[model samples]
Target: MKKIGIYISGLGQSVHQESIEKYAMRIKNELSYNDTGIQYDIKSEKIFYTQDRESTVVSIFKSKNDSEQELVYKLYDFQYHEILTTKFKTKNLLVKNLILFGLIIKKLPQIFLRIFASGGFDRPYLTFYAFTLLLLISLAIIFLIPVSIETASQLNFSVTIPEDIRSILENVKSYINHFLPISCIFAKIKEWLVPVTTFILLVIPESKTLITSLATEFACVDKYIGNGEQSQLILGNLDLLIEYIAENEPDSKIHYHCYSFGTIIAMDLLFPIGNIPSTNVRNRSALLITIGTPHEFINAYYPRFYNNRSPIMEASLTWFNVYSVADALATNFRKDMNRGPAEFGIKDVLLLPENINYEITSDKKMNIFNFFSMNSIRMHKCYWDTSPNGQSCIRLLFQKMKQQDFI
Candidate 1:
């Protein structure tokens, strides 16, 4: 049987193709004990389509023994939304998107809930989107069809209208999307809106879904997670697994290997709207291995969002959270709270000091910001790489995957 290994990247720089390769290398070598070169063929980039701005890269892996069997590794990074926001700050595209994003985020749960209730968001749903887009656009223009004809007839072309008057009318017509030009501001907004909305949905957090399920978790409002679709793409793609579980298929198997903010996104995906209502959905994923998870930050600082959010979803599913004392990104509080796995349905928790005793050197930036400079960031970033201590987080996770029969 083949396996699906999905990686959800944490917050920060986007997970480049190399990062995916290295992470897969850890899984391949640590589990299969093979160092076959792993590479990526980017499935999507810039996510500039529909304004998704996320970058998705996938790696195909075949089992060493069974050529017919393999694992497909996917990295869904919603970093592009943030990238767009940060890179084009003058564009103010990010904040400009809040309304569009908010509306989409609000409606998504109803869409998803309807899907699961009816079976799943499969082929029909996709087809619906296409037809719906066309139908909606057509409806918007329905009233204009006759009006356009009327305007055309009223236009006194035989009267030789002044050029400036014609130009103003042309611009007005363009504003109404009559005959759009590339340079028009309305044209730009129209052009960018879909893409921005696409990007926002691609990385929109499940917190909206969470609030949908447990309305009181918010006490007042919903907190949608992620500034980008790295999470949304992952979640949308993850719908496949969720569908499998909803159907209660016998062969469905999936797992999440998430890092940093990626872990938070994974949390929203797994427990969107709080605890899963169905065992099929809860047990669909074999396990969740979180690296440098910041669950503690959410749980403590943002307790409202964390109130009903759980690291573990079911008694049967294995949830392994990998954190290190030195990694600035990982947290210890969530692990401490989930000390009793059975209580929370979590199988196990790990606090790795992968680089604990490793020596740190500070060359020191000669600048004033040196006040904030430290080597811990170095340790956090390099946890994937082998250190003198001979323990890497990736390697540790590979071992766990095997032990848990996730491989």
Candidate 2:
């Protein structure tokens, strides 16, 4: 029998330990295949375990043994080397070099064109143009030069958007739209230019700095929903959980199962700093399972731009996204009942009951009625139920982990 430790977060630290113990026991009973004892530990972080203790520990870090750790480090170095080599050969670098060469060739043409256009060969203007051309070439070369994949992956692309400030901007736009006469030429120009200028500013790197300042200003707004802050908090907790598992059980591997916000946090950790660590230590124990996660939300928010790839997609990791039609949060759950499986990238498995109105509330009550009733018709509520569907889903998740040789 393997000793498994399960860690759960999201629930605050004020939660009673007795409740956690009971929950752990129930989970253990549900997943029991033998005399496996699953221990549950609740902290202000997220972790999950099963009946296989040794495997769990190994999943947390690269290796328990010194030889394996050394090998992992060496493998990481090799991957970095590969990234550098590949980057040097990329089309972007070639294009940049070609552009610089083209600029050099056109130097005389530019000078002649300027001289003819301005009625003289002005040395100062020619020098300015030359300098400008050099500056452009230099910038192109610098940006086009490919760095190691490890280094590229470590780049931060996240931008924080404050709701209150956005609201203020919206209000200003609205006021401008309403009170400012659209028929007036100046007003029309302002309307067109405002959005264009905003778009251009956002494209600039300095926008991130401005956003940070704005976010600080709106920090005290009571109605503000700090999704970015929440994301960071969840990410921090995940890192802590991973570090804990790595420290406590060096030989075991870590597998993750997540739902909603939990899924987002999992992605953040797996794809930290825009790079997925290709080391065996990182990949060995990496199996991700996401439930009811809005992976498409980022795309939806941005429209026609699929910028946010799930960490599962970025890394060489095995993943399963479980979704149900009965969950309101699942994409298009209310529109087409059969669409859930397809939307979630899981076509074969249907976890929700057919034709069940997830929005409807039932009169039947129990001790845990509040928990289940909160989202009565939604698939999210199904997790709280001790039904076979939920049980099977949990069991199958672990079973898949085992099949991946994680156990």
Candidate 3:
């Protein structure tokens, strides 16, 4: 019997598994009809089966071999006609949709909870009442505060500066005396109105959705980079994704995946030094893909920045940088710049289309939330979206890996 394998991708849920099996069986049936003597087996986290002329092996594999065979089958099916499409064709769309559905399966429990709680009046009413109370309190505070230039200057420093700061003590007293009364009334009025304005702004549904979506995405990758108290979050998320991969494909001898902040954590695991011992697991990773990774510390501004000479870049077994035209975070400033399809003695830096533009203004510059734009929400999170060539870029990546026998 000629052996063929199928590996299912996406979340393991009852509904998703049932649908995948149905589709897999349809494909198997089609192939069986087309080729008389061919035999095939399909397996995923949830299902397994085999079909041939002589006999059928529909029992689930109890051990690791069973899971591996299913994975092989799923991968072969993915690389078949679907990945060959140049545009978003029907079959490709179907597969992409199925994969998305599978991902959704992972979130179904939370989704159902949301649906269940949506109709309840208690939470909504409580939220509204709390918002109203906060608004009223803010208004009262604003009205009571005065807003003169002297008063503003005085109030800003009141908590920090002591009366005994000899040189400026007289100047501070004079400043307050000049502007306190006039500034006080204006400040009060402004304070009363600010909360009302903020409340109105938050109530805008579209703005709220956009903010929520951006926040959700930010939270997903927040702990991975930058500074401050939550720096460990990146390590936690990387560990989570790694654990996910390991749990799903324990038999995968050579695991390869890319990440931004996650790259640092993964590198530490791959190349242990100092007191840390190596995680001596049999299943070692083969490739490391890093996109927009900051190898050296540089200035945060546009004109003033210096790249650090770090050896981290030299250590990667196989690394690829999938960057964007407008990715200011990963600007190339090497001494001998190489451009075009293949440069820097590396294969190619896949530059994706610039799909988002973010603007930073003086007034909104202080808050972290203002850094994101609506376009960022659409471009970054749209991984499942089909590329211009009609294939899901994610699926294409998997296909390319499989074709090269990387997985």
Candidate 4:
């Protein structure tokens, strides 16, 4: 029986044993009540008092299902690499940006690769997505190349505004003219308003710096996979974990639970750039479950533009993609394919449910914070948490995890 749990993180996350335990405890409490507890012990502090390096692993022992089976699971966090990047980022912004952008060019399409690799090869416009990175690279090169003298020379080109834009501007001018008193009052405070408006815009979802930082960290993972820098980071960590388990407990399969951008890390492990796949470890991974994953979101947005060789991860065992309808990142829940009348010779693509199996559902409640601007934003981070009332999706996942159908 599977026993160990591995937690793969997204951008801006370090391992928080207590927070993770909250998620697991919620599930464990519910399962125990039903007489189906997996009987795993969650731990963060060191067990060996003499040794300095403590165990980050959670030990699952004396399994009720396996007649006293014992095993160890480790909390594997690649966020340490990201933390290092952040710690030293202020020293060299240019090098960091250049490195991240380079990786984005090389591995951004891994998101699409994961979707197609697992399944959905038959979906329409599939070939178009295959060349996603190539198209982006071509466009980037075009933008970066210095223009020739003939093109660089001043041209007799006059930009023209569309009628609608011109009309809107004219209307704004007329409104100000009609409200001259109000306009005069506004002019007195224009200086104050401009900075305030800019501040508000910067603060809507996240500050510009924060957004850029998040993007940089995301690209770092891509670079890690593309360049194989510190290629043994995850593998080395897993090796230590395996050795620890070998000495302490019976062998057990590792179950990885990924969230948000962590799902991207999971994809790299599944369809890894490193020679050592997850299966190479002492106790091979048994299951991969992702909550608030953004793989489907990438597929939804990748097709509109960009052009070649889109990428994918095929599964041997089980992968449960749990998502909420409200989560903005889990956007690819349905496909649109519609046809018009035969005589008219036209088509209208509408909505269709996802074809793949093992996608678990969680109920989502509307959030008040979402009303102002970033409606989809709150859901992206909170699927594992409780909703408006006490709708704990994490608890729901525990129920599903114990079921035979999901297994």
lDDT of 2 by residue, 77-153 (tens): 00011211232234353443554444445444544454445322122232333334333333433332222222233
lDDT of 1 by residue, 139-241 (tens): 3233333344336535877888778866766666656665534344534444545564444334434323322222211111122342322334445545544
How does candidate 1 fare on TM-score?
Answer: 0.46
| Local accuracy of candidate 4 as per-residue lDDT tens digits, 1-407 | 43656666555422222244455555445544566545654445434312433334443333647565544334433334443354445645444445545544654455445555633321223222323422332333232221211122223337555667556555655565576554465444455544643543554545334334544554554445435444456445545554555455455565667776666555545444423353334246556677666654444334321122112223343566565555445533344212111111001112122211222344434444333233444445555443222345656566566673332
- Scored by lDDT, model 1 comes in at 0.43
- Candidate 4 TM-score over all chains jointly: 0.52
Predicted structure 2: lDDT: 0.36
C-alpha positional error of residue 239 in candidate 2 after TM-score superposition, expressed in Å: 2.1
Give the lowest summed-lDDT range of ten residues in model 1: 213-222
RMSD of each: 16.7, 22.3, 20.0, 14.2
Cα lDDT tens digits, model 3, 1-407, are 11222222211110122233443444344434445764555554422211211111222221245334332233221111111122223333224333333333443343344334533211222222222332333333333332322344456654665555533655654665586665445556566456654554554335433333222222222222222223333233333434444454555443333323333344444443222312322233444444333222112111111122222333324444443222322312232212223223111222211111122211122123322232221222232222222222234344444454553
By descending lDDT, how would the candidates be arranged?
A: 4, 1, 2, 3
- C-alpha RMSD between model 4 and the true structure: 14.2
Top candidate on lDDT is 4
Judging by lDDT, tell me the better candidate of 2 and 3: 2
Assess candidate 2 and give its TM-score to the true structure: 0.38
- Cα displacement (angstroms), candidate 4, residue 384, comes to 3.1
lDDT of each: 0.43, 0.36, 0.32, 0.44
